[model samples]
Target: MKIHMTRILTLMLAVFLVIPAFASAAPTTKGSAADLRSALGNLLGEHAILAINTMQKGYDGKADFADAAGALNANTDELSQAIASVYGDEAGKSFNTIWSSHIGYFVDYVKATGAKDNVAKQKAVDNLEIYRLAQAKFFATANPNLNEQELAEGLKMHINELLKAFNSYVAKDYASVYTTEREAYAHMLMTGDALADGIVKQFPTMFTGDIMNNPASDLRQTLGQILGEHASAAVFAMQKGIDGAPDFDQAAAVLTMNTNDLSNAIASIYGADAGKAFNPLWSSHIGYFVDYVKATATKDNTAKQKAVANLEKYRLAQAKFFATANPNLSEQQLADGLKMHINELLKAFDSYVAKDYKTAYTAEREAYAHMFMTGDALSEGIVKQFPAKFETTTPTVPTSPQVSTVTMQLGSKTIHVNNNKMMMDVAPFIKNGSTFIPVRFLAEGIGAKVKYDKTTNTTWIMAGDDKLAFWIGQDTMQLNGMNKKVGATVFVKDGRTEVPLRFITELLGWNVAWGKDKATIIMTKAMAPASAAAHNMATDMTNMSAGHMSH
Candidate 1:
């Protein structure tokens, strides 16, 4: 097995690095009790992830606190990042250092235990208590405005909850493990809320301006409601699939209602028709997840294959829904999003099946978090296309663009034009000079700024002033702005375009160099001040004052 003590040790380091310690709550209008609670929950969740990751990694070894500690470290890092987003760089740095060390003590204990050194283990555990006290005092001093005694109590609660959860995991009481995990998660949320409450009481205005202060307006609430519904439906569907229950229809109806709530919220942010399309698409996903879970329970190979097949069907339907809901979406764009979503679910399910609870929960956390992205994507698309509705609203930001094509100049080399979209994905067939790209892919991926003229049998690449056109089966290109023509063939290969890569790059004003030995393509260009440069250089330190305390 890939699982081993060494792997567990590695994971322990990760947990210590990622998870942050709780801190005293300062007054922030944006901070809330819920915020505090979530922080605490995340702290516990981080421990669970590492513990589980450790157990999975060291399946053959004695599962212990070392695994838990590694996960805690990783969670601290995650918390530090989230804090950096709120507070400034210094705060995150401070948190990473402080929270990370506490988990180190746990590792010492684990190593001691492995060596059968009770005295050393006892010393390590005692050291943990001292470290806990120092941490509590650190928070108290760090945030002078917070009630030190109250903060200490909260911190103790968080540590105890986490310790208990870790213990259950060590005992291999899986049900208790999960229950404790959830409890720890909940406790963190509570602690976070307490901290946030303190802040809200201290500084009402700054935090109040953000929707985070309003429980009714909170996006997390919407996500929780929708996800809860979806999860319930999924669970029921799986049970029905397993028992071959006739009452499955009833459960599905309830699930639909839950999905309806999700879609309705989406529609409110998007539109009615978009919401309607999302309902079935969303429901089908739940059905597929349920089918997969059922197959796993029965250890049914054929059933699992059928479930995977069903997943494909669900993907197409989901893709179609996205296309319909987001009219501006191209087929490639839809396919990319669908593939990511499908992969995430599969990864989470695989982790769950393997009893690798750490990865499973991590995947769950990611999946839950991603739903917000889904909401944001749909919202942004609606607002961008139909500016009349969904204007002037704050939604979660989308992921940064991974693919970009820019123009550059190198003296006489005066490089211009690059279809970077095509260049990036030629891994399958670079042996042949011509690269094949599906026709529908152009509309979805490469950027939606492209147009396909049906009557003219030409495809237009909308970049800047230069609009390059290519027709089928001919090695000729036409500039839409200018009547200038260049030699390049757009031949049909397996229902895709086999166009000239150099021709596309030159059109985009970029120098493209290909390395045959390394199978690498490099594009160089000057940085544009109009985009990423103009943005504030300050590390996101919006809520820097709050991090790392017990609850």
Candidate 2:
């Protein structure tokens, strides 16, 4: 599938990458964890997509099904080889055999659906159940980390999801088809990640870092997944539109899902207003691309040129949006990358229109892969812009009082205080560029006394020697009787009075850290700075030394 840039998809990558802030406790390493997991995801996701297209074509008795099936088989081989490369040639061959069985069963089901043979379909389903057991066993035998029953259950879900999409397609429920198709594709990515995790554990020396907790690496992987899906969705939608295919509306609707996901992603990182503003600009290029497709289909050169010109405007607009949002991002690099994304998408579509299927497919792959580069470049810029957000320092710093970390998800009712978990009526939320958590959490979790005075519309908190007072909708808060302006005003949300997290915590000589991963707040309690703690220790030692001398 060609890239839409996938227009907003580039933005989508930027949006999704900002999520998963607590991917791992380990530092982001491209070598073992990120690269391997992403590589597997790429191949597995591609396989699921190709299989869907191929099966659909086969059901329709389309000639291109052969080539599409070949692509799917190639992916299967690559996956086997990846396993073999880690284990041995025999292992690879065994994986191929077990994997091939599942694909064969799916093909049988497709053929049965085409022939209107319910019995054949049931037989195919039965065969898939057997294939699931074998596939699960193969993986379980390969690694102790992978549970057989769990693998079997996951495989069943995979089988059922694909069948559901195919059945929906057969029934002409295009919306459900695309929706389930997306779920199936995502499921494959999870499968790839699971395999990577087991392999990484099996050979710890071969991999450098953990996969689940590295926020930066998760950013890279998630960006690639979202952007790659965008490319495929755009390609499918554009093709349907150009062909006047019955599923065009459904395909386009799925594309809209991508747009919303991207917009929400942007909102999660940038802000609600930024995401709202970003959606229209980000979606404009897509409409422009549709114009290009419409023009191309009608052989209207002038209209096509106009569409291309508009895309150029979109490219600049997209670059500017990111640049304006983040000065750390390089406009030149973004524009160049977006230009390549646009060109490859256009090239793929043009090739498909000319009946040059090979060229079209090749260009589609390029467009999909290019988004990974975009993700990498954008993630680097964002990481540079917000280093504190990604920093996860363990082994708390030395202070007179031990530092205790509190981890809170943006909208979750649960909060993690050091090793303990507590649930609150209200969750943390971002307001005016700061996170706000419930005041009661400070008292219950961190051994602080907090009170809300309904008459005065004020709240007070005392953590050790630190005392802080703030008023609702107020910009200034009194810290130890001295008022200080904060990034956000204290306010009431969801029937709870919320204070600016950093302003209140950091004021008490504590540290506040949150994530690009959906605004996860990690506040550390530090009663005294290390310098003050050291000075106190030295003074006490000197007094003791003087007393010894006097004695």
Candidate 3:
């Protein structure tokens, strides 16, 4: 298969180079901007997600590790194909070799973690650093528009982000692991866009106008990203949900966050009321899917049918909701699209339940890729509806914050994190004389990592080197993994877990304060602490070994 791929890449390069002016050979460019950007973003983002997922599976010695890794290799080949198409056969060859080497290094890191071999892990890291330079240099040498230094820095960040997520996973810093992993995924989109830009610049006649400079295209690709993420998160959540997997809650949390992003985007474009109404409409479908999975687990056909009926209702309602918001979007077309989504998800889930993993994997990819089409359609309608907001305007990239602060008013459904308004399904309320609300997002805001284990109904928080864990309905919290007496027990409300806001925040290295009115709580993360080293220390190291350890 590898040799066959090589020959195919060589052929692609020959065709690209041999045709200098193939007016008879070049493709048309009507929506080339959106096409190229979405294509690159899709493949590159998948690479990040698959790589990290493969690494975790490898580390865990999961039964599906082989399947995950195989999927990752398939992605690598596709990426190389993209490179080959742009940079010709030789660059593609070099990219595959270097890229494969880095993935091998990551594999080695995971293996070393299993063996508790710190030296081997460091060796992997050192090899990765060398691969980083080679990768950047290769790209720079291939495309004059791409800078060697800047490319190297981006490569370095990529390496650091992937490693940091891996190490955080090892240290059980689940919140930051997801956060860093997501940042890593987002970082790859930037890389893809840069790569796409360089290619379009070098071969303008082939690719047409600047895809990199269009805001409308940006909206399209951004929507593709989050929408694809929603598909992925939903699939994984279903898989975990059926298995009662340890990370099931985390998977669900990911789905919820994706919903928040989609809803927020809706709010930004349509109106707050539309976004607000959209949440339950969106969440209802998720719940129905959950029901489907549960029914399938018990072989309850009637329950499964009922779940399907609920989803059908959701599909029609959601379609109308969008059509009502903008005339450019047709209710029938949207209903058709929603039907496709539902079928794809059900197929993926059903395949997995039957242990047909190969089909399940393919179906999952199909579902995910379909969302890009959905995004393209939705973005087109939106851009058409509000040309003044999207077509001519450039969206600014958000900069990293200097300080992160969050405020919550007692008995309110809204919270402000870094001055950004976030609405929760459940409102903050007094329980046992303590203000109670969800802290997963809040703790994450203050540079803390949060993890929820579904099996035990426990939530864990990590900051710098400090750790705290508590089980639902338990009065004792574990400080640094040891049981400590805490008078408060977290309780689940409205299908969301609520914790004592002040206690949980303080435990995760945040300073808590009450406003003069005594109804508002403010949480701020202050001072400097060692973040999970992006360079990453040996995660599996134990006992007394100072030969290669760093704090």
Candidate 4:
């Protein structure tokens, strides 16, 4: 086809640069803030690389464009999820709409380039300009501290740099293309840093220490960089494995180096003993993933299953090691979370084997995003267990609820709670006339104790003398040692344990008021002695320790 390289490069540049702007602004702890930065950097970096690769492939009339495009869409899904982690599902959906539109515009630009249609190319550029303004406005509104004028200026610069890169590529300037690509990748890191800094400053309580000012922030960022890069490299390796690409070995080697970096970081925090234990367990999982890919290529279903079984064992061992290393880390919860990670990677690999590019890319994006959570959990645990090592400072106590009158809607998984202005990973919804909410969000909101028993798939809530226990996937519950039937079944959704709001509130002697017109459920606790409430809140905060806080 020998398509117009310049136009394709321009479209790629425009699409990749705008993506990171939307990828910013998620709720995170000190460790997670670092993790978030790393995740965004890797995601945006990969997008840039993939966009360039796709453009090159299109220029040469290669078949890899579909795979690249699928991977790009996967990146979009992940970016949306990151936003949703801080914002609500509605906001995430809204972001996807705007973000995807720009990608579509770039695709149109590419088509025009291929067809040599100058008019269509100009139209696409016009659309992109409009998109740039809309995106800048969206983020500025979301985070007031982010200067709209500054954001606009920064975006303009991104566009200019991308155009320069594209024009250079068109002129067969390989050196300039490589130089601009590096600049573009590095620029997104700055974008991620700015976005993360703004969000953390806006919600100081949600993150660990001041990301902008703390030394520990550097540690978190380093960890995030290493771990996030590992995920991106691993996914790229897996894709190369399936394609039998010549660069597969190089990509695989890079992935291994990333793992070594992660291990070195662990050793720095926990000493060589812990690192020795961590290296084998961490590296083994990567090996297993590679094995899965190989088996799939050979049509050896039995070998694939064996690889999965090995991963399950790895998850348990890894979870236990972290939990034993840091008391604040829950073994069962870690395992549960780790299981999701393992499955996501396996699914991505399997889908790739099946030649389902869309499904493969979707799984790849999910697997990549899951690593940030893993990084958050591990870093948080390490920071908590060895605070002095991180040069961490104690957080000041707040006198009031981070937010007043937090609201949740029925049949929606959007939770508006916490000081960070981030959405709960799981949303509250109505089931069979009773409202269901994430136990931790509601219980922790009112200074109640919430614990999960992974062995029995049950959750325990203690608010004063009244204790309630519910099993996942069951309608039966225990109220103060007595068996009781609930209107709605307790279940686990989106990695959270959910329970009926009415039953739990009633047991705790709290009022559950419903706003039918608004389809909202408001839980109000009766006024207690000020001293008592403060004590309870302090206790709850203490229970969270440093690592246990939501990332």
For model 3 the local lDDT of residue 503 reads: 44
Clashes per candidate (backbone, < 3 Å): 74, 7, 0, 2
Displacement of residue 492 (Cα, Å) in model 3 is: 37
The global C-alpha lDDT for each of the candidates, from Candidate 1 onward, is 0.45, 0.68, 0.68, 0.60
1-551 per-residue lDDT for model 1 (tens digits): 43422123223322322343232233221123333333433343344334433432233253332433444555676666544444446766876776676566656655665567889878876776776666656555555434444444445544554455545555555445443434344344444444444443444443332223232223343343244324323432444344454445554565665566566665554566776777777777777777777777789878888978888777777767667666866656666766666666667657645656466545544544444344334434443454432121222333342233333221111222244323222122321223223333332232324576777877765443334566775544544321221222366554445454433432332233333342344443222322331121111111110111111
Instruction: Estimate the overall C-alpha local distance difference test score of candidate 2.
Output: 0.68
- Whole-model lDDT, candidate 1? 0.45
Q: What's the true lDDT of residue 223 in model 1?
A: 43
Say which prediction, candidate 3 or candidate 4, comes out ahead on TM-score.
Answer: 3
Report the lDDT of model 2 for residue 377.
70
Model 1 sits at a Cα RMSD from the real structure of 25.4
What TM-score does candidate 2 get on C-alpha atoms?
Answer: 0.68
lDDT of 3 by residue, 192-217 (tens): 76777666667776654455434466
lDDT score, candidate 4, position 473: 86
Candidate 4, residues 374-403, lDDT tens digits: the string is 665676666666665445323345433332
* Candidate 3 ranges with C-alpha deviation above 4 Å: 1-30, 207-209, 393-551
Worst 10 residues of 4 by lDDT: 542-551
By TM-score: ranked, best first: 2, 3, 4, 1
Return the TM-score for each candidate structure: 0.42, 0.68, 0.66, 0.50
- C-alpha RMSD (angstroms) for model 2: 14.6
